[model samples]
Target: MSTVSTPGEPQARSKPPIEAVPVRHPGRWVGVGIVAIFAAMLVHSLLTNPNWGWSLISEWIFAPPIVKGVGVTLLLTFLSMIIGLALGVLLAIMRLSPNPVMSGSAWVFVWAFRGTPVYVQLFLWANVIALYTTLSLGIPFGPEFFTFETKTLIPAFVAALLGLGLNEAAYMAEIVRAGILSVDEGQEEAATAVGMSRLQTLRHIVLPQAMRVIVPPTGNETISMLKTTSLVIAIPLTTELFFQASAVGNRLFQPFPMAILASIWYLALTSILMVGQFYIERYYAKGAMRELPPTPIQKWRRRLGRGGSND
Candidate 1:
């Protein structure tokens, strides 16, 4: 069909077809560079390893009481962290509150906990002779039935629990605060526009978005809390991982090896937590990464490739 426009008639121009822009994957050089670095690291590790052909890994793993005591350490770490997480969230809210009294109370709690040596805090908790001298709540056998015995109430383990968990909460409150604040302000506004309450917006919208920023430090805190539980052995009532290991080491006169064994278990435990961190971070990032960020190389590749297309 030849439909040419006359000289006096207007000519119609065809619009350009929309094309799919291909994403620029990294070049072969990047993969080669990464492989070279990894190989160099592996070679260095092999060359510098203290034991080339032998291992005490089996002996380290099979130690009976040490293995069991690790369970206790894990228990203490997990329990305290659970408690600390709740306490931290509360304190974080209070610290960020508009009310002066609430914020001041939070500040005082953190100041006292972080100011004192944790060792001192543990000791004070273990010997918690009296939280308060007076029993203001009730009478022994009168109209008020409730009573708390000064001597019987505060046990050493309970004291240790309070000290470690509360101390951890103070540190974690700051971490939570920072994580919450790191969320974009626009998210809150959008959530509000959608008719969500402030609390609702914070819980469902802000916190979910802030997970990537929060997870790394929270993982570190978990590992730190695991090690910190060893301090509970000072109460002399219960045995933590280090306590059990140190006892056996002192008896056997293989103090160095036993201590090393304890450290190895701790590192293993922490490594597991680190792996969990990667998965958790990825889970949180899945939705966030829907709009992928263009890397620097991707930008340059696109710019360079555009030249070829234009030509």
Candidate 2:
């Protein structure tokens, strides 16, 4: 029921709605403006600078030799990574072994490789024929059953692979060991209680969980390996991307431009590897995370959907 107000009494009134103001981040805006200005300036310089020789870069970028070099680079990267990863796993297991001999041997392997410079190692591999003219397959301290010349057996390509792969294995061993150690001791104990052998426990229980740690560094190493393939020049492996680009530059008298072209290719390859690494990390994160993060495509799709609804 409505009530009538008494004459001359004070009247009640409704309060006006409050208007909210967003917090301003002036510092952030200033930083963004500074970055935008620098970026625009860089872009402008790139477009305007004739000395950069963009035309030369474009011309040599797709040349047959360059393409072949790219293929070689990829092959080297893939093979080296395979060697590193496979041997790294074995070394990591050995490092963690109960026996002192196995662990000590693994440690020595790691130490020797890690202590030396890869360039020096590559140089040594290339010149190894000087030290050993012939290698033989036979029982040690017994008559040789078969013999092969070291120079013939270890070519430039083979030397490059050995140098890069063996060096990478030393690094990968540490990475794998760190990943394995990241797994809880309880997980191994539980597996053992359930009648799992050491190998079985590592394979089924520990390694799976450890992958969350392992995949990231492994991905980084893969990308690093791609660039490090450039150092195969120490082996005088002239078929690699950087060496090919430099060769082209020397022939054309435009070394700087060719270097730029090689860099572009490296950047593109590295970007692709980075994307693959992201997905791999996500895959291994399944059990660890409550919800996996969305991919770039998924994020774009969501944004597009929201925009359409807004429209």
Candidate 3:
């Protein structure tokens, strides 16, 4: 028999309550355990190993020559990046030029530098004496404005700087070009409508917006340039960090410890660079995103708050 409900009566709703279930990831736990065990074993080995010569590492870590080498490495990084970025800006502007000749020249220069191995270029520059007896600043086959003996003028240090700076310029050119291209075309049109000159438009409007895209990569390049300074060893630049480390290691017959010292210094330098990069990235990120991402410290504080609440 079926029963009919009155028109004014409300029907009772019957449904089970929905409950959330936590997902199980046994594989993640297993992976974490394995990683923990491996880390423990590695730490134990490093601590117990006599062959590591921790004392020698400590001694050489702050040695006068190594300290000087660190300074030299920093100087090279600063100078190379400055020169590279300057040249890169010019090349990028040329690449965007209306003139085919300007664009073509920029392209060729970038292609030549990027195509060759940096190490080989360094070596060639170091031994450039074999290619040219003297280098001249004046027009080719014309009146000599100035001339320099190749051997005296292009020492190992100069060769290293030239190679690193020039090679870096090729990469920076591409980076800068990408940044320039990221700007809105409409922005440039609006600037032009306002009677802004091309240079004025680029300087005042386009570049400021482009920096949001450009800065992160530029920071990366700076860090990379810092590490690339180590490769100046190919030029046999004796004052550089890696060369100094190797020389000291060979002399002491404790190459492993010296290597460890170098690694420590490199790690410290990279840590400092990473912090600078973080701040620079944050500064440029302003107004680009609706909400800024939390920094590490903020994340930690949030975690602490959550943990306290749970407790």
Candidate 4:
């Protein structure tokens, strides 16, 4: 059945399509503008400033002495971290041992090293010959089979290592302990139930899990060790980066620019360490995360794909 339309009746109308407006974040844009202004100011200052001695910095940054100094710095960082990590693991195990003597000894060692300043420790090691002119190897308080001069035994480099490595060991012990403690107690119990020995359980079960906790701080400590190599100057050891830069400054009568150069090198080395740390952390995160975060290359590929699709 058809209905007849009334004269002068309004015609049926369709509603207009809804407009979808995105929510605006004005504050975010304001914050970005503020940051950009500050960054521009900083860049402007770096470019315009005449006193920075950018020419001198470029000239000496790759100089032979500076290059050698960087090598020494890297060597010191690697060797010191090795000593610290190895000794720290032993100390941490001792600290967690059932025997009171082992735990007590570990505690005392950590306390002594952590209590003293590193500079003082370096100084003492440098002058250790004052206290022990000769060191002998044999039965304690009995006839010695061999003796050696302390001066010949402990060079300035060795003294720096002793100071830095020993001091770092104390700190690393605490970090290792924290990482060990972060593991679930039930994991160890399950390992024991499987007939694993204490050492085997710790090695296969506990330490592997603990590494997730341990690696981040250990990386940070590695970077700190790189910088702390500067304090070897207190041992009057002159082969490291900072000392070399300072020597160059004194020679050229341009101390401030040389200091800046040292800082730039330190920053560059630290950035490399940070990249390594990121990858290490990502590796350890595999078991913990259901899906790992994208790497830089993956992200770049994704962005390029999106851009091509849009085009």
CA lDDT of every candidate:
0.78, 0.94, 0.88, 0.94
- Backbone clashes (count) for model 2: 0
- Per-residue CA lDDT of model 4 for 1-311, tens digit only, reads 33456667658544455668867889989999999999999999998898899999999999999999999999999999999999999999999999999999999999999999999999999999999999999999999999999999999999999999999999999999999999999999999999999999999999989999999999999999999999998889999999999999999999999999999999999999999998999998868899988889998899898886532
Worst 10 residues of 4 by lDDT: 1-10
**What lDDT tens digits, residue by residue, belong to model 3 across residues 219-287?**
888888888888877877889888899899999888888888888888899889888888777887777
By TM-score, highest first, what's the ranking?
2, 4, 3, 1
Number of clashing pairs per prediction, in order? 0, 0, 0, 0
Comparison by TM-score, 3 against 4, better one: 4
lDDT of 2 by residue, 180-201 (tens): 9999999999999999999999
Residue clash pairs of candidate 2: none
Cα lDDT for residue 166, candidate 1: 90
RMSD of each: 9.1, 5.2, 5.3, 6.2
Error of 2 at 5 (Å): 21
lDDT of 4: 0.94
Please, what is the TM-score per model?
Answer: 0.70, 0.91, 0.88, 0.91
Stretches of candidate 4 off by over 4 Å are 1-19, 307-311
